[model samples]
Target: MPSTTRRTAVAALALAASSVPMLAGTASASSHPSTVVSAPLAKGLYQSAYSERHHVLWATTAVGRPPVTSSALLKVDPKTLKVQATSTPPVTDAATGAVEAVYGVAVDDEHDTVWTTNTRNNSVAVYSQRTGKHLATLPNVAHAREVVVDERHDLAWASGFGDGTVVAFDTRTFKEKKRVTVPGAAPAGLAVNERTGTAYATDLKGNRLIAVSPYAKDPSFIPAGNGPISVALSPDGRTAYTADQAAGGISVVDLRKKSVTRTIPTGAGTLSVATDRRTGRVLVANRTAANVTIVDPAKATVTETLPTGPNPNHVTVAGTTAYVVDKSGAGPEGRDQVHRIRLGR
Candidate 1:
């Protein structure tokens, strides 16, 4: 965690409010049962990842647009829904002296580090998981939107949302290892299969899923629904699920056949998706609907609709629990919040 001095210096960047009133403690009237607890974290909460090894949740937030001055990487206790530590990015823009605001986050448990996408600055940064120290910043990544680490291969993959590209960096060396481009495609969310060293990215503009294999000469593309912004893979890595934002549905792709087998309507503006390894259930965050939809992939049907706060941006599973980060609040300023959804086993 960050030192007392460092935390105090960045305290102004975090929202002073603590946990919000419990939003949903009882299970909804649905097939899938779960409880929701939310806490106001900061402004502009975008994404979150749960670190199984550390038993903590990692989230990213960037305040305001252009020349974003306030942004932070938060470490929170999943059980209590309380922030444990906060670290701000170091100023990397020498010309403007503005800090790189973090938006997307992924935990590299194998290396005990966290990778964050500095979306506004077109770069990605590495931070120490234990000490909350800024380790490295790889710049020139065009509009980096999401990052996922392939710990088995020691690589960190980032989606270049603006450039239609995906770049992989050696986690150990912090150097660019490979770059793959799909012209005219705007790649958004990214997911890597650590077992195979293969990465899948959502093409928001092209309505496709771009597959980047480590040994393949050319990347492959699988047709998806409209504006697939975020993606997740099954435990076996044979199925790829995409959250289609524009279509307001979930695209289930058969990796072996390289085709979308089904498009299940989840909710309005399905922005993010994550699979629970324990139950094989898929959770989708619907931003516009302000709820989290739980889909049973086996039956290809939505089992439950968990109403979160407004603008649910992202959801990540830790064990049977799911953490949802939203961009709206009950108050006037609309501070962002992080929700802990207990999905009982």
Candidate 2:
């Protein structure tokens, strides 16, 4: 009797040990470390941001060239400004179709994964935070332009550049949960105020700003400046900024009025805009002028203009560092440099 009881306990413990992985697999994975691997893009980096958990800068390379291909995503150490890891999304065989151009990436801290959008291929790719493994691809999207992840809402919204629609996917299941139509035309940029269940899309061709209530019906468009290419919101969510490439200016829109309050002119051919919540200043990247215009929202004036590399297309504010991608040429050999601009210096 004693021997049988001991054997039964041993069997039950073995069973529990064998099922441990199966049970824990259902839970979310843990985040990985921050490290640099390659610096292939010294010049042509188009966009970058620092991951709050990983403490690394994630950058997107444009659609061109050998080293700076459309699909390349670089991870850089924030402390050292050195490349940590370089990985590409899964690509289909040429016989079937090529991989889409990855234009944007958003880290989901909840799942310990990175979500990237392939604009031309119309797909969203998920990668592991630790091993950089290709987890899966969410397909059937249309002309995906940019993506914003809302972990609190358990959703990821993508802007369709060709179809003029915005698609929302459930991050937990990676399934399309909603498809909202835009009021105007080509959806070029996207911004989401998840706190209010509101998302905004900028229509470049239509010269309007489309607003969507993620929890409600069809979205509405508010007339903004001409050729609105990029959109960003203040941390307080009281104001929004739109970068107008055609108008060569930044439209300041009051969220309460949902209308353009003012326009701040910058170098011609402005492509991207970002707001620094810490300093309360908005940064606009001007492609044609090769400068970054810093605007003080409270004062409604351009506070500073800093010179950067040739053809600076996108700018991201990471703590005290400003990462600007300068694409000198349209081809693969185009020398693009990611410059680190120390703020308040």
Candidate 3:
């Protein structure tokens, strides 16, 4: 967590209005999904997720407090781009005495809990999904990047980018249940398959993906591209696509065998990945290219590149809509933007 004074300084950078343009440009128009609308938000963008039960979208950003109070969760309308609610998730880490700077947010609609990765505090904080009230905070996951809630198994899984491990916590009691280690992997993002009782994590440093389960002796690896930062799984949990930032492509993995099936070239600086299973589309956010590449998984080829911003790093698809979060940097850290694109299907 940043100091109070530093938080105030960081808050100044996010005071921009939300009237920025919708979509920059479209390289291709398809019957799949189209750019519906993109709006400008405050800086310090991280991740976006959709709540199916509530039929709304939620996004997280890293910001200091000043003129505005600190509530990292923002409830957004999926269709109108209107900010429905902003929750100030205020909490001081009992051990560190620092407020949570949530960088990753995931919605558990069934449990009505919003799970966030408190990156600065090296922990994950849970909140009431609707009211945004602090429910619980699970500490000890050093450098936690993203968290996925397994409602069926009553578990919450997280990736420790700083410690090279994937930890799991009991959802009912918020207790440490299991930890699967991946030495030197620098695990950043993970996907949990509740039905399969397995989890897949990406190793940013090792350039591979690992599947972990309590029944397995050790984690199994799937070779991915260089600098793999994020990953997404197919609906059936049979395939996974890894966003290779350094390699500038998407690595398709056969999850059943834990092996790379193909390396599909997307574009330079592919930072994040999200899949729309119904349409068979894979979306990758190219940070260096500042665009979103819509790839057809069956063909393993890029179909369209839509302009987002200077750095489009995060993306998630809800129904026919794709929400992309961009983080700008350097001067005042002015890179908070959420671009929502609509799909035609």
Candidate 4:
């Protein structure tokens, strides 16, 4: 883990307050059981995840204090969730410690390419899944926290932590296309509604969610409550949910209203949020609690909470299985793990 100061309790509270985007209560009266699978992972696990469409998982292994060493990109089987291959691409010396602080992973299923953002390195790594090779390195991404590939538009966008800018790229050529600025800083997580070409970004510092037009200037801003860190859109694109790290809950945002409808409490350090479009239930990884809370958006209620890996950071859905990445240590020197749960069981 990188050796930066942890977000304060007060800051977390503020994040809870400002990070909740206006969300609509659209969850139907449906209940589902959760099936959990616990697994151990390597050390220094930050937040990279597997790309099912590309059949590989992108993971970062950090080393050294202040994390001066360059990050390692390890490839894994999407189906098995184990390492398939590995590579250590050349990174900037200034960013060596942070390069590959791989927080986000996205796959261009159509192009057979994978993309990841190095939070500490301030760069993006483009790799080929079929060939198991590093394709290109795009540098100078200020606080590049998360990346999402919009296959419909053939573009990859990253959330910038330092400049509060949303960076977009051509998935094929790794060329810069557009940079959209938001109203806040520390853009941590992202989600896109391809049907609408609307990209939603969660601002870690501003406690707000900014909806970028991806086609217009000055994307609209929506309140997300406090500590808005990660975001996920509903399968239908009508609603978006943000995990409030400091606030201990998930902020529900209604895309149609562009406002936060409510903050649904989950657990301590709501690290990540993912919605099961098939089941219409929102899952939140409570990092501090080592469990996940299932939220019913229709009733604005937390229907069920289930235990998971230690310090679960990101929640991903594949077919019917939900995978959660857990970095046991909260700070820069921590180890990592991954867990799985079957939804609608």
| Candidate number with greatest lDDT | 1
Task: In model 1, state the lDDT of residue 282.
Answer: 94
Candidate 3: residue 284 lDDT (0-100): 92
Tell me the TM-score of model 4: 0.83
TM-score winner between 1 and 4, please give it: 1
Per-candidate local distance difference test = 0.84, 0.68, 0.76, 0.71
Better candidate number, 2 or 3, judged by TM-score: 3
- Superposition error at 123 for model 2 (Å): 1.7
lDDT of 1 by residue, 1-345 (tens): 111121221231232243443544333455546766666766778899888889999988888777877889999887666679999899867787578899999999989999999988889999999999999999878999999999889999999998888999999999999999888989998989888899999998888899998778689988888899999999899999999999898989999898989889999989999999888889999999878988888899887777775789999988778888888864336677777777844
lDDT score, candidate 1, position 88: 85
TM-score, ranked from best to worst:
1, 3, 4, 2
> For model 3, how does the per-residue alpha-carbon lDDT over 1-345 read when each residue is reduced to its tens digit?
111121121232233233543344455666553543455665677888889989888888766643223546788776666678876656565554345778788888878878899887788988887787889878888889998878888888899988888988877788888897776779887888888768888998888887888567788888877788899988888889999989898988887787788888888899899888787779999999877888888798888877775688789888777888787542234446677776555
Local error of candidate 2 at residue 188 (angstroms):
1.2
Compose the digit string of candidate 2's lDDT tens values, residues 1-345. 001111222233233222111110000121421111111244336566557778777777655532323466778765455567877765555554445446677777787777777766677777777777777788766777777778789888888887788888888888888887654478877788878868888999987788877778878778788899998889887788999999888998887887888988877999988877687678888999766777777777776666553577777776755666667542235445554555552
Give each model a TM-score: 0.91, 0.81, 0.86, 0.83
